[model samples]
Target: MNTIRNLFPEDIEELRHLLQTVYRAIYLYQHDRSARLEASMRAAIQSCMPFLERFKPHIPAYKQRYIELLKQPDRMAPYDLIICFDRAIYELHTRLKSGEIANRLPWSKELRDLLNERQEPAPESTEGDDAADTERVDFLTSGVGASRGEAAGVARVILDSVALAKVQPGDILVTPMTDPSFLEVADRIAGLITDRGGLVCHAAILAREFRLPCIVGCRNATQVIPDGEPIMMDTTAGIVTRIAK
Candidate 1:
């Protein structure tokens, strides 16, 4: 697909606006989907309440946590709540289908085993590892390459949209993540680096739309890379390297 890079300067500005509108629409669609899913989940949960009540004496703490979250959504993050609901539902379905709960087995142990099966092993620690210390002068961080190309610019660590004013025309944007709000400065950034996000994430989508070199899911780009330092993002190689002074 043709990107903003192929367009004239005036066309680039207009395209940016159009892309921002498209992103806004995508965000709205996601919001609506979440709302519909939440409603459907609530109804399903309500239908299963009688069955849950039967196992009230054997209900696990995680299941109870989901119940509590349903009662107090304000106390937990939206993503956390969604994950809790998902796990709870999965467990309920598994137990119902397998008839393990009907066998009068240890409920807590069964639930614990099920949860453990889905748990990912923790990543190996890289602490005190200086094997690459010599390369640190040039090698900063690396992540999944979301966009194609290379760019070198002064890194601007913008934690929020409020700090976007500090971004110059050719500055590279480093952040924990990007949302639709980041589109306001999309036309000005030379590249994008994000601590979180995958190939199809908001930052990646925006980078492709603008034909900007982008690295995402760096996990610690905001902390390891200092603001105002020159950095080179080679998206094709999936690396962001520091440009030594």
Candidate 2:
């Protein structure tokens, strides 16, 4: 940690990478409840603090904040990355019908390092989204921003490009999460809602890039909200409340 924090220079990607290393095995250990993983991640990060403190050239604010986190102890959880990843892997297994695949575990080079030698970036995230699960309900919500916005509009849930091609002009898109693959139709949409990731997730990034209203991390929102129902989303407030329209 001291080596990564001090010698490596400070940056988001480096911090993200270091975090992946410290807590790489979090998802691999399946416990009774979600809280276990959350707590475990906090512990993992907390365990790195002493190393961070050893940097003699640290600035005042950085040192102060580091000391404060160590003081509180319980405030170390990184929700967006830590807990979300755990839930994401669990969701992935269920969605992929991952049965023995999950048990056997198909990991990438990064994940392998995290699990094997603790030397590389942990797998950023594994798949868990299937917004096209027509077996569920969807709420169309809208807000000022993409990430953390409320659900709204015509819930246009599609599996892939073929289904994406069928989208009507003013529909709200809902996806497990989006990659660069869906950008071609960005202008035709009113908004987006997602179930697999948080405000910092991919859909949020694209929404910002395209100036679109969107929301994410609704957590099985596809299963709870009914299709065609209008919603009031407040991204800043991290809310997606329902309303009649």
Candidate 3:
């Protein structure tokens, strides 16, 4: 870390390149793998504080370098980059400030096809052709039941945190996973379904407290369940059913 921080003075371009490389991994890992990588990175950044204390006076110089690079929209802001840096120090200069370290995963293209394709109303079937809009299985998929209960409500895919404000009472909150920030809107939703998590994750703890039905580790809930579609969360059986309207 000290060596990397030292590179900040070698040349502005080199520092920017290092920042990009670190953050790009965060961007792709969040999509392709999980948020745990981000969580770990943040933790490591926090660990660097003692070492960073000696460079306190030079922090502004480092930040100004980043600001100049960020002026080019192609270069992601350090905050949006999700690479580990001091949140408080960086927030002062970066436009992309965030308190939440881990972010929810969004629907993947492959999983979207699996859920939407089957539910799509088939074209009108002609003579000797397979019937269109044939009935499909009610339950879309299953996951680990984090909380025990059942809930039936419309699925609301929260691909971005901006949508948290729009969540309504009795709606099913579906996402890649939940972190501390998600609790802000947890009460409004009837249940929770996530693409990833385990028994110890925040979703499980919240479900138990809210007494809401919850299924984590679904792996594809976000892609499989379309926003505003009625879905049944059977936490007892760990199944999320997509109901035809």
Q: What lDDT is reached at residue 3 by model 3?
A: 31
Worst 10 residues of 2 by lDDT: 114-123
Among the numbered candidates, top TM-score falls to 1
Which candidate comes out best when scored by lDDT?
1
Candidate 2 or 1, higher lDDT: 1
Q: Residue by residue across 69-93, what tens digits does model 2's lDDT show? A: 4546554344333333333222332
lDDT of 1 by residue, 176-236 (tens): 9885567778999999999986664557655765678889889999998999999888886
- The model with the greater lDDT, 2 or 3, is 3
Over 4 Å off in model 3, which ranges?
1-136
The TM-scores of all predictions, comma-separated, are 0.47, 0.41, 0.47
Worst 10 residues of 1 by lDDT: 114-123
lDDT of every model, 2 decimals: 0.63, 0.48, 0.57
